[model samples]
Target: MAHTITGRKRLLARVRRIQGQASALEKALTDGTECAALLQQIAAIRGATNGLMAEVLDGHLREHVGAEGLSAGERERELDQIAAVLRSYLK
Candidate 1:
């Protein structure tokens, strides 16, 4: 949640793309498009969203674990938080 400005910009772009995908899905539904095709679009949007999340996760790990120069206790806490998040995401 405490991403740098550049990271925020990247996240904004991903969000905009997801919004566009949602809009497309809405239009497809309104137009009575094929359900299978719509499902595929939904899957694509899900993948995009997951990809964005992964990027943020990786960035967070690098910033907090690699370059922050934290104390041992702080690093362990960050690792625990990261592990918990990953477990939830995988589930």
Candidate 2:
């Protein structure tokens, strides 16, 4: 919660940038932009979204999981599960 509060502005900025990207994507589609350009916009949005996910995941790991006194093996297993979920989600 403290991390979220402190990072609120930065996170909101990222979200607003993503929203702008979405708007641009919509405009491009409406204006019949070229396929290559449209694909590039989509890739940009995906990259930004992935970045945001990584930021949140990092904070979660540090503040929640990392603070816990889990054994090395347990931590590794937990992280592996998280990675699996992230992979499935991205797919």
Candidate 3:
């Protein structure tokens, strides 16, 4: 429930789509689908996963770090920290 308030529906929709892509990938593997087709599925899943991550991260920033009274420098530092963590996580 990363998005408890606004955009929850949109986030859930993305998650549902990602789940569908994952299920499709599993089915393709079980069916011994062609290599190229499997690769395409994998790519789509990866893109969807990345999109979901970006959405969650955006929500986190807006909710946790984007407080009403934070100074500009503090916000920038927080954003930098978040970006660093994301880079490490992706790596």
The C-alpha lDDT values of all candidates are 0.88, 0.87, 0.87
Q: lDDT tens string, model 2, 1-91? A: 5667778899899989999999999999999999999999999999998888888778767875686788888888878977897889779
Off by over 4 Å in 2: 69-88
Q: Which residue pairs in candidate 2 collide?
A: none
The numbered model that scores best in TM-score is 1
Worst 10 residues of 2 by lDDT: 59-68
Please give the distance, in angstroms, between residue 31's alpha carbon in candidate 3 and its true position after superposition: 0.3
- Off-target runs (Cα >4 Å) in candidate 3 are 1-4, 71-85
Error of 1 at 51 (Å): 1.6
Count of clashing residue pairs in every prediction: 0, 0, 0
Runs of candidate 1 exceeding 4 Å displacement:
1-3
**Which numbered prediction scores highest in lDDT against the true structure?**
1
Q: What is the lDDT of residue 2 in candidate 2?
A: 63
Model 1 lDDT tens row, 1-91:
4665668888899989999999999999999999899999999899998989889988887778775669999989989998998899889
